[model samples]
Target chain A: MNILAMFKPNRDAKHYPGFGAVGVLFFTFLYLPILVIIAYSFNSNRIVSVWQGFSWQWYASALQNEGLLNSLRVSLTVALFATLVATVIAVSAALVLERGQNVKHAKLSQGVVNLPLMLPEIVFAVAILILFSQLGIQSGMLKLILAHSAFCIPFAFLPIRARLQGMDNNLEQAAQDLYATPLVTFRRITLPLIAPGIFAGSMLSFVISMDDFITSNIVSGGGATTLPVYIFSLVKQGVSPELNAISTLIMVASLLIATPCWLIAKRSR
Target chain B: MKKLSWNFWGLLPAYLVMSLLMVLPLLIIFYVSFMTSDAYGGYKAIFSLQSYSQIFYTADWDDNLVLNFQYLKIIARTLFLSGATAVICLLVSFPVAYYISRQSNNMKTFLLYLVTLPFWVSMVVRVYACVLILSNDGVLESGLRFFGLIGDIDSLLYNNAAMMVGMVYTYIPLMILPIYASIEKLDTRLIEAASDLYSCRMNTLRSIILPLCKPGIVAGFILVLVPCLGTVLEPMLLGGGKTMMLGNLIQNQFGVARNWSFGASLTVLLLCIVLLFLMFQAHRTSKLRELS
Candidate 1:
């Protein structure tokens, strides 16, 4: 009986009562609100809650808004700079911590780098806001870029570190046996091997920097707004179809960027 | 020696940025929390414990001090709501994760992808999606009225219950993914062996699976709990500014109230709570590691 059961289990073995129903309900709960947003984005009515008929008018209006455009510009600039700074430092940190066996305080350094991820984002935002103001840093864009880059480091660093750890040590050893210099070996072998991880990390941080609201909202000081901060301000006056149209656009754009990141991260794993 | 120096140079920039930008700022906040707030949203640089004391006491109209319950109530409400979110997420996530882990290889990948896809969508957008559904004459209201469930078109938004729905909606994926990861690693053969030995399913699950997946449940709980605690957008948007959370209270201190010192103190309190949770998680994880 044990041998037979080992080869083939009963039909109900994996089935937990009510699990299937709960799973189905869980997915519905997850997707229903998203679907409602997408549907309402096309509503012809001015008010977001009431649906009159299908129309693209809100999209047209959203595109023409100067404040929205400027916010998008600020968001893109911040994400670009933050992602660049974060990815470079992340690669350096990953290389050192993963391979430097004798590096002192390596565990402590890793913990410090990851502290932002563990704490509340509002705490960090409040801290950075105080830091910037105390130093009398007046440029809103500069404040945002600096703060976002600091927070994005761990998101970018973790994947690269994982990639480095998973790599076979023998390949580098074999290259060294062939008398290849450290820089040459790193450029030719190590860089290419972890390029996917670097890309994945960059993409992840870019999405994170763009999606940030609380930090940007607080740090921006209402001077240079990001897209999220802009959308949030609009919501204060109540939801509008124009806001819906802008939201749908932002969702689609993030999806377009994030899908490739997810695919690469999965495939590399 | 030269090679080690080169490695140290490579690591310095990363380490310096985190310390100077992130860690140093937190330290400054710690220092600033004890200072006094000036009239112009600036600091006085004078030592005071008034910021901390203000959390528990307030001056009455008679110029006598009284035990204040306002901030304490907000803190309690924040803890209650965040704790409830974690519990609800775990209950829903466990079954869903188990179901996903049991699927065929392709189905598992597809389901996991679906689970993670919403995470990419901006959180503000997702919260707004809740507003679209819960507001008066909204999609849910419209649908309900069509079914003749109610007469008047009243908004279901701007309450703690509505905010809870929004919180669960946004943070549920965080809960699901961690549990799925741990459940995916579970040894199915052990489960089959238990059943083969005449053990009932519930007994096997309770004894074997639950203990094995405890790490995941704990991880999922913390993952959901942390963000839910600090959430500002949900309370403001879904709760319609009526229900104030810790995040909202902090924002007000900085924004409208202009109490930089007080905000710093509140932030310090929040930081301590987060650190406590993280330390507890670390302890449990190490204990679990020693066991296995």
Candidate 2:
């Protein structure tokens, strides 16, 4: 839009706001709702109507809530188990994928792995629901774990693959020339080198599985509702100060969990 | 002894796992989409074009069939919403990313973490918070009324606006990270050179930075748009299920309506559309690079 003006102009960096006025407004729009949400969390109103006053009562209630805690427990466990499986698959796949040959077919494998990412979570969830039902594997912790792992593997693979592709190829070659067995080389040399990617990818998978609602909704089978499903039921069933408190508690919980990953991705960079 | 291909003999564990676990379920969807519906609920093994035809044509059923144009409209809306959201996300994230990129290293990392924090929270919770904020008699409605900004009440929770808000919330970070990475990679000397040559700042920006950043913009656009397009939960939970997206329509067909073929068709069509968008984006980047 500003392609023609560089030929003659005094520097007016301050006068011309770098992004223009539209940009500031955009940031405001992007941020205002979040600030409002944070503020409203303390509203004394049990209902979502206008706030009367502020109090810590909602946070207090959220802390005491057992149902929310149980749901969180389920979600965390699912995320943990799913990430464990996904990390193993992803790290191995990354090793195989980073071998720097069969590039065309390798791309196909990537596409196949990423297919779940492209498909709607609801559709994936629905498909898994149908598949599990047909196979007579009733929905439970096991199904949730497997379903989440299936979806999480791709995310886990991409970063690990990225790091493997970006790293110095000489290390592996040098280890091979040293008479180290491939397995031993991988365990000693490659794994240590790519550990950061593994950690980041695993964390990413864990967060994704934790946040997943659609697939969890489909496969939940009324017996093992995750926190997201619990929140959905809350919104549909009723609204109260309790739900608000729960939302606040979630904010705190995610903030707590995400902090470490955030720091890792930060300091390592 | 030889070049071991990535997918060679040693990697059977991965190939077997994904092929069996992830690949099999989708293959099941493919088959289920082809089978004919049964008398009571499930499908029979009869090879029939009846379900596929019924999605577009009405001759498959006795009397209760409805024209499937509604599904098309829903798909259109989904595309429109996703596109609009992606464009808006780009506009919003671009400057923020640029400004953040120009900051010191510590500030940049801090800003990046801040950008990522909201995203780590559950999508369901975020949508629920949006619903809380926008529901009738909710914070927004009464806030407006309390200040006498509007004399009457209006609901925001179940509208397209709410859906966009939810979409933007989830995807703004996706948009920002790519653009920021690209911006971080930008050569500052070019900007200084343009300044040294007394080139107008806007001209330098238009001629240099934007073109250089095209790849990242396209990447960010796709990262934001694709998943947002297929969102069903956001529409359902935040938009109150009042408006239907293609994802919702497809889900309804498979779940409630027992029209697997139609849903599969919808899903396939949407995937094609996504592919087209990505191709178009890639073409634009290549063209822009050529011009520059």
For every candidate, the chain B TM-score is: 0.95, 0.86
DockQ of each: 0.67, 0.42
Best by DockQ: 1
Residue A92's C-alpha lDDT in candidate 1?
A: 84
Candidate 1 local distance difference test against the native: 0.88
Model 1 chain B poorest ten-residue lDDT run = B148-157
Indicate which candidate wins on TM-score. 1
Give the poorly placed runs of model 1, Cα more than 4 Å off.
Answer: A1-10, B146-154
Which tens-of-lDDT digit does each residue in A1-269 have in candidate 1? 98887557445665677787899999998888887777888999877776699999999999999999999999999999999999999998888888765787887878877878998899989888989988999999999999999999999998898899888878887898999998888898899999989988898899999999999999996479998999988888787888888888988997898788878877877
- Stretches off by above 4 angstroms in model 2 are A1-32, A49-56, A63-66, A99-104, A165-178, B1-10, B57-68, B146-151, B192-199, B279-292
Per-residue lDDT tens digits of candidate 2, residues A156-231?
9887887787777798899989999878988999889888889889989998998888788767764687989888
